[model samples]
Target: MEGIAIKLNKNISLSLLALIFFLIGLFSIYTEVFSGIDRMILDYKFRHLQQEDSNKKIVLVSIDEKSLSYFNSNGMYWPWPREFYQIVTDYFHESGAELIVYDILFDTPDFDRRNLSGTMSDRRFLQSLKRSNNAILAFKSTENEDPAVDLSMNNEPLIEHYNIKNDPPYKEPHLLTSKPLDKFAKAATGLGNTVMSPDEDGLIRSIHLFDSLAYKGFVPTLSMAAFLELQPDTVSLEWTSSGLRIGDQNIPLQDNGDYLINWYEKGGVRNGTFPYYSFQAIVKSAIQKMRNPDAEVSVPPSVLEDKIIIVGASAAGLGDIKSTPISSLEPFPGMEIQATILNNLIGNNFITQPPTWIAILILLLISIGIPFVIAYSRPGKGAAAIISILFAIIGIGLALFTYERIWFSTGLYLIMATIAYSGSAAYKYFAEEKQKKEIRSAFGQYVQPEFVEQLIAQPNLLKLGGQKKRLTVLFSDIAGFTSISEEKAPEELVSFLNEYLGTMTDIIFKHSGTVDKYIGDAVMAFWGAPIDQDNHAELACRSTLKMMQKVKELAPQDTNIHSRFGIATGDMIVGNIGSYNRFNYTVLGDTVNLAARLEAANKKFGSNTMIAEKTYEDVKDVFYGRQLDFLVVKGKTKPVRVYELMGEKSDPDTEELEKIISTYQKGLDFYLNREWDKAMNRFQEVLSLKPEDGPSETYIERCKKFKEEPPPKDWDGVFHLKTK
Candidate 1:
């Protein structure tokens, strides 16, 4: 009962520890205690795992170093005249481009009094914007209110038509507004905010689709503006707590109303993720077309047709570079970030983070499940299981991101599992050490040192309960102990018995046997208990042989002191037996009784050691012995075949013993067949070979008595012993 209570308490303690870890994980997740590490893991997944290909419909037009150099040589410096944009817009409008989005801000009108061509340049750019209804211009929005800027300038007539309806009136505060100059905003098809918000880590992982301005209402991002313009008709926009739904497409959003951007590999310039073309290349193509109608252009019509082109500056000096999840060492361009957002919106390939409940549930499972598994398992096996589960979680997260575009919180799960394992392992180590100390204190003097160690390593073996096991039990007693005790004085006899018993006990322990007890002149021991031994029968047999040899060496030259052994192998109950206050680690069953009876029967056969049939069968290959008789003891009804154990097969006199055993078996066979004369002849031959062969001499007398009596007709050959 006490052991059961201890076991239950241990399990409860492990569960409580697991619960503590689970609560810690839950707190960490909700509080974002390890968000930085979580983000790093997310970035690692994006960088290494398989990525989705960039949308081909989106194209990038970079005003790179080459274009800047070409224009500078031609006397056109930075912020080139608006006529340059007019030329590119006219080329794209004539080439059948679907949408042309400029990520550049044009908040002020060109007014160069010295050139006198600035007004003309502005007029030409305005005319191109009105001509190409697909063009969208960029503007800026800020949280800081600017008193110098007229706030009423946000109420432009052209920006009002793209108002997205919010049924519930999104209560999130809107930012202060800025817009392109009135003439340019009125001439362009639409205007969008170009402001980008990066994460706390300074990486642009998400973008706001719509910014609710202070008074101008909701303003769409540059990407969202182009997307809205591509719609076949004016669609209703509904905003809920989840996200905005435009027409039939549902866009998932974070709590702050930002859509997570699924990044693509960093493929730069032409022949990369998205097809790239230089500003000089587009301008040169337009010039070539104006010069000759049949001239081959740099960017063919087919490449630009039906494509959404994003025109933005990419020169290093422009300071448009931003860090992104996929951009590790390389500086990602702001133009490419805009292009990526637009691509995600167009394709509906945004990465969605599942609900907080899902992450919490995963964290809870890992924290609780890992400790429970580790608590019941061996140390080495438990460590292996923990490592395997961690990898499986990572693989599952990566697989979901790669194929489903779903982001699972795997980093938190790993942290929770690691904590659970660490706590469980430390507890197990200390608990085992405590168990070892208790085992040494309790069983040190009772059992051998090695047996105590075995119990310590596997403490469950010390439970106060019996379990049925196939075991080999040994009973050894001194032959004629009453007479030997009568001959020696009390003090001398005590010393002699202690020496004999101690030697025999040492031999039993050496063979990994547990000494059940020591009766005055007898020793009870067993194998296959406290520790499992598959070769229990062989071990018991070997111990008995060594004990017999040691007795001869320990006895004085004048005195005859011989030890006889009996061994039986069968199912027996082995465990602690008796009241709670006092108990003995021992085995009890019919097998044990048979072994004790065999020890007493050894005196009848005049043999040093005897073993039951089952024991002989188990060690037949290693031991050399001969069958004695199918004798039923006084209290037993059923008969059991017994064998007198001889030396091992490796003994020097094994050949001579084999010949004697062969003769003895033949004599017994004749006796069982009722051939009295032939049985006497075979027994006499065995006795001649071995002068003191006990079973042979006894069998010869039995044959003689049977010949004189001419026993009953239905008589079987089984012999019954009258004494134990």
Candidate 2:
């Protein structure tokens, strides 16, 4: 229940966060278009340059890929009412009385696009778009639309899209934006079209079809080069109104009243001549070093010298941005509609539109076909959406950039994909968190509290395997336990031993020791690995000392037994050492055997605890100890110097034992010299001070034997015990 509750809470929190992002995505759609219009129309001066000596003559000015970088991390923001606007447009207007067709929108008038305050009016910019005999300005038809106008434009059909590799079939790409046909009509005596072309992920992907206007019963876009380039050579025709004559070419309106375009193919690896001018640099050049507000300048009469100029933003952040055909770097101002119109007029080239069947096929395949693929794709692969969106956007952009009129869509499919991916990810996150909570709660109580945590953090460690390590093993027995058991009733004896063993075990565990087993009245434990400790020797000694004090206290209460402890230190295999069906975390080595041997030795010495030389060597400096013997513990060949731990640094003052220790050393030296009678005399002296001496009794008996027949002449004082 607790795990479930935790999982539920986490899922609820993540769901709320996902909902917030979803709403933000909806809101973003509306705001994105406003930001985009600025990018579309920055240079309205140098556009519509196909018609010479006409009131509609204009030049083409590009905001270009470079100008878009103004919105980069280090860009100068809120572009002021700089010389860019004043010089380019003002010069053109001053030169002659021509119509100013603005591809730029003046929706929100601000002095500089960067700063909100302390700037001048862009009314000067807007008024320029509105002036002259043939001036036309563009705006959207989405006055009553939602934040973003998700207009679906009627498309020209797709042509061939295939490859040799076993690739997926083609689909119709979505439209970027609906062109405001009504607004276009109001803006120009000769209309310029406006479109918002979106890529697969709702990014602007490209400039739309240019030759679209030549189809029957259709009007041309605002961007045709012929419109600006040909005055003598180009003809202007009104539907059902007038016959047209352009240069040496004469055109008559068809019965359906649409003009056909004569297009020339420009093959791969080369480009048709499209002259580019930087809007920022040109505006700077126009205003630099000019003294007079109205200075007269003359230019040689040429195709674009007297033409109308259109300006627009081409920067990605400026919002007119589109993933382009040539690269993902394509962009054009809203004013480029005017430029495209001029380009078409000059070249007499136009795009061909496919029939309704083709449109239906493209739309059906893209919307239905792509979604089916996306829906059926394995949930594990997130890049399916990315690759789908990229291939579609880049494919369509390259097609348009290459002048292949394939009905392409990128933006709409991306919206559907975002919903799919984000929703799936959020759901999975909640599910996985729940699984973790379940595992945590399941084994929590069955294992040691920390063990469960370790298992959860690293599940692989629970496998049945372990490594060898150096360790200190201890064995302890209750001194005189059999006599106490015989004296007491069964209930009393069992209760007494339980209380005694329980206390000792607590101390061992408290000191980071692992309890190995219990033998009737004995305990086996070890320290230093089940997670290694650099101070296993120290910890073993410390646990041993604590056990002695605790068991001594146990003795007075129980009156049944006193504890005998033995400790030894050496390398051991420390881990789960048991069968596949049953297991125990334990330590085993020669050190363990010796520790048990030392416990039995404790009985011989009449001491509570005895440590082998291996253990004493590790901890001698920290405790008050005496060399008890130089005897080989059972199961060992070499006689080892063992010690009896008198007390630790914290044990209450041991001045008396300090004196006994000094006397014992003297007595021990005398006994080792083969003078049995002399050794007996010194042992008898130690007994005089402490009557119940245990080690001295053994020395006295050995002396008595030596007095009768003496030890071997080469006896080395070290007693080598042959068994463990």
TM-score versus the correct structure, for each prediction = 0.71, 0.47
Clashing pairs in 1: none
The TM-score measured for candidate 1 stands at 0.71
Task: Tell me, by TM-score, which candidate is best.
Answer: 1
Computed on alpha carbons, the lDDT of every model, listed in order, comes to 0.82, 0.53
lDDT of 2 by residue, 39-143 (tens): 222111112111222223445556655544542334544353433454566645554524444565433445445443323444444344345335544433211
What's the lDDT of the predicted structure labeled candidate 2? 0.53
Best by lDDT: 1
Local accuracy of candidate 1 as per-residue lDDT tens digits, 1-724 = 6457667888898889878998898788768788777788888877776465656798889999999999999888888889889999999988899999998887778866446588898999999998988888888776544434456555554355553666323334345456677888888777777788777889877777876666456778888888888875678788776688888988888765677777776646744467789999999999898788689988977799999999998888998877888776455778788888888888888788888888877777787788778878888899899999999988888888888878877777888788888888888888888878867865665467988987887887765667889999999988767887898899999999999988988888888888888888889999988788899999999999999999999887777668889999999998777776666778999999999999989888888888999999999999999999998987999999999988799878678789888888888888888999998898889888888777877887888899999668887877899998
How far residue 395's Cα lies from its native spot in candidate 2, in Å, is 27
Q: What is the C-alpha RMSD, rounded to one decimal, of candidate 1?
A: 6.9
